[model samples]
Target: MPKSRKRKATVPAAPPPPRRPRPRMEYRARSDEAWYGARVVVQDGWLRVMFENSTEDADEWYNPGADFASLGDVEALRARFRRECPPLDHARCGDVRPGDKLCLACDIHGDVEELKYYDAVLETVERAAHGVEQCACRFTVRWTEGPRSGCLDKVGIEVVCCVPKSPIQDPVLSEFLDDLTKRFAEDQGTATAASQQADPTPMSEEELCGVLLSLKRAPNSSTGKP
Candidate 1:
């Protein structure tokens, strides 16, 4: 018999390495800006929240303590933001609708809370545009699952000044803006008069002093306290 050709042993391909599970956190919540809003991030045995601001530069990040009291506080915290921050004018000025899922800017009316990391002004406003009833506008935040975190103490933070999201009037700021506009107009008028009919000399020291004193003494009728 002719030499039989030796059959070559076939080598099996090496088994692929096992895939590692991805470490990821899903953040979902109501926000005024794209990322600057109340959000909850769920991760390995932990739930993290940042509601003070919706931006990367938020005043604080609330790591809801790993307990019942902290978990219970979520609802109340959302309620407070809804009560204080003005809702974005989605119907008229913004892209959001009643059901559309997207973040809208908030109308922060007053100072932020120093200790609680919430808005200082808790009272809601009654918008005249709607007439009679208080503004239905509010910041809404919702999330699933219980909370867990390794943090020990609540964070104390100060947030940046909030710009209005729409034309909604803020009781504290509306009058102030009106006065600001008036002051600007007056200043422009003075400059125009000086350029057109008077000498180009800068304001004298005495005139500056008089203006400062007048501003200091000017009675503000807007705040009833004054």
Candidate 2:
């Protein structure tokens, strides 16, 4: 009888390690500065908040859902900046730029801004703020009727949140941009390789003539006739 070969013991491959969870972001507020969380407007129309003073009242109004007709025209809105707003370190940054919208929970002092002057490079990256006219993000509000609903009626609230430029920069967004750039490079490389493989290399003139001659009958070797 022939000897039988024994099979070697096989080890299973180990599974890949699990992915780590993404880091959570925490927005910081300056010692003197505080963010009034989203304030909701219950019934339609604006209600002037009654506080110790106009500055305190406007600060309360802008909290996460407070209603405002534009961020101004109210006495408290104008005075609050001078009264409630703390003096900043001017050495840190210049004036605000356009297109920058504020974040609710992030700090206003930690933000780093990207500035552009010339038109050529301006169109490449997105700008956060501009001049004194920064971007404002609006919150949708529906008017409701309370016991006093008949007093004012339906009016939408326009919320002006802080632009991150004056505060904290987002780390998650920076990472996403980096990932997008790498993906674009890989996709372009794949397309270039595919194009190269689709077209075959050309044959030499000598090769083409030899191939044609082989297919033709041997020039009448025995007969020596045309």
Candidate 3:
């Protein structure tokens, strides 16, 4: 009689690996940006990121210990850029409508808490995290399941990546903010000269000296005090 052929076992395709976790801070910042103008109703364990209607239709849940920055953060960042550079306009306003791609950003930081060991080391060897666990040990041991290792103390971070605002700044938003700043000498010279020529009143020496002193005291201020 002919020998019976043995059936071969078909191997299954491996499932795709899970995605890397984002840092905690990063998660906060994104949540903040996404619900910028939304009527965020934070209650219980979840947060509701809402639309202008203040209804529950559009919302997202956020857990505790997460950071969520509103549009205010973008404005603050822009303000800093403007102050430092002075040549650009760094103010961001709600003038930007929905669907418009405006500048955005966030920040995150993480620190691992507990150590994880191999499934089989006591599969006793303590976990040596390398991106993802990718090794098998020589010996076998009873394995207590520990948290899967990587960096568990995730921090999701974000920052204003980019934005489009004032028409005057259409040319360069990524460029140094000072680039959009008004060239004082070029911009105000004509007006100053014309005003000086047509002026009906000229101040006395003491008055002029006082004005100079006030200007010197608050050089950075938009208006002189004292």
Candidate 4:
């Protein structure tokens, strides 16, 4: 018999290198003035970023590290933005009317001139000229708190921010409670009707009191006393 051909040992193929995790869509970077929203993209084997508020051309690419100092994810950036820049009360501003409560910025002069916000009630709103923008409308407000309390002054809409509306105005919760109350009353009425049908004669007050007293004096299992 012919000698068996020597078998060549086979080498296992190497596993592919682990892939890098893709970057999240939401990112923020700080410029000299404020935090700007940014998104990352991979182009020609290089990671690049673009800012939402960038004044530069849209096609311009920025280095992640060299361009931005403190880079943060979406949540962190939002928190920072909230802390640094309080949002304008657009809801209240939209439907502002007389007697509406508002918080407005006040310029206070002491050792240092400081801009502060104080609670106030709107007294009147003066719309801008028909040709002009509504944002130019002036509001007359009476201060309700702080050193300027009870004072009335005309201020631009920009100085005013919306007061948080009370949660009691939520119609969903009110409707739910109303439905629940009606259902509970109906159940109680049904139970009472069933009970009355079972025994048509009503119990006298004295008999009802006697029954209650007997129940009160009945055995107490835990204490072994009536």
Candidate 5:
């Protein structure tokens, strides 16, 4: 009988390496001038955060310190996203209508008291008397974001300001404005050069004195009496 072929010993397949836990967004932080969603994680025995909007190939770490006071719960973070402002002509409090969007300063209570601005929608507007200034106006607005989202609060013109629509929002208008600005600058430069060329050069002290002396010695041209 042919010897049974030695059965090749089969090695068991190794188990796949354990997967890393996905980062959980637990907090929001502000860096520079903008707010970003963030997650806290520990590395090398130190706490660090990864910003969701980071512009980097690898995760960038940030130290949450005094500067992180801007950091807050997700609700507060959401509030930082301000709504677009109204048109330039409608930027004044008096120009805002019941349906217009505006900004209101809100107090954030914590270890440190802070005033934060949030987007709000005007529900009602109480304008001051004809003679009174716009600052005297009052408004009822519903918070669009933040811990007070959807809550209505009465605010004064002092605490509320119109959010002006950015020129960049309209590409055509923005381009036109840019062209106008360039032309204005060029015209100003040309005007300055022309004025400089038209202006006469200053005379030296000696030349000025000599001219004055000659004028005094010469007969007065305007009056025959001289």
Candidate 6:
């Protein structure tokens, strides 16, 4: 009769080490003097965003559904742009250098500024409505209405509602820019007319500052995009 050997106690192997979380790809704004967000554009029929960095080298096209871990790595991002995006003709980018306090490319058509403002407002709303139920985000931009031709006229914005998602059109942002551009055109026209009659009185620095302050206080509608 074979004696049964004592069964050894089975030991469970330790579970594999938990995976390290992937770093979130968040690029900060260029500078306090500049817009509080990145400059985005639709170039060559592709959505692209000019990183808010102190260099033109970070400009690259973006995929709405693609992963952006590369954004955290500048060199890697540039390489990706070189491989994927259109050539840097400077025709669309203009002379916008990080050296100046202004972004020439963004300011060329004035759409970038509006987009930047929209981005800032969105951030504010998020911060204020954090952890609160029934909080809604509303960002709007004009579609198919701007100079410089092409699809640049059609504006789109990156919107965040409940969960994070890709860019979408927001009527608020759209109306804001639309009204702004319309007023600008009217102001320019008036300025021209006044100039022909007499030296147009430019708004004083204080008055200009006031106007700008009001813009910064753009009303936030208590609604979310559907």
Choose the strongest candidate by lDDT: 4
Q: Which residue pairs show collisions in model 6?
A: 140-170, 140-173, 140-174, 141-174, 142-174, 144-154
Cα lDDT tens digits for candidate 3, 130-167: 32223221111332222332222211111112232333
Clashes of 4: 0
* Residues forming the 10-long window of minimal summed lDDT in candidate 3: 81-90
Q: Each model's number of backbone clashes?
A: 5, 20, 34, 0, 1, 6
Sort the predicted structures by lDDT, highest score first: 4, 5, 1, 6, 3, 2
lDDT of each: 0.32, 0.29, 0.29, 0.50, 0.50, 0.32
Instruction: Report how far residue 99 has shifted in candidate 1, in Å.
Output: 14
* lDDT (10s digit) by residue, model 2, range 1-226: 1111111124645633423222122211122233221112212323222222113323232221333332232333322221121211222223322332222221123322311100000011122343343332222222121122113221111122223223223343333333444555676799789988997678899999999888675677778754
RMSD of 6: 29.7
Question: Model 4, stretches more than 4 Å misplaced?
Answer: 1-94, 110-113, 129-134, 167-226
Per TM-score, the best of the predicted structures is 5
Model 5 scores a C-alpha lDDT of: 0.50
lDDT-wise, the better of 5 and 6 is 5
| Residue-level lDDT for 125 in candidate 2 | 19
Stretches of candidate 5 exceeding 4 Å from the true structure? 1-91, 110-113, 130-134, 167-226
Q: Model 6: what TM-score?
A: 0.18
Q: 12-109, model 6: which lDDT tens digit per residue?
A: 55633423222122222223222222344555434454543324554445442353322233333332211111112212222222221111112233
RMSDs, each prediction?
28.0, 27.5, 22.9, 24.9, 24.0, 29.7
Name the lDDT of candidate 4.
0.50
Q: Which ten residues in a row have the lowest lDDT in candidate 4?
A: 1-10
142 in model 4: Cα distance from truth in Å? Answer: 0.4
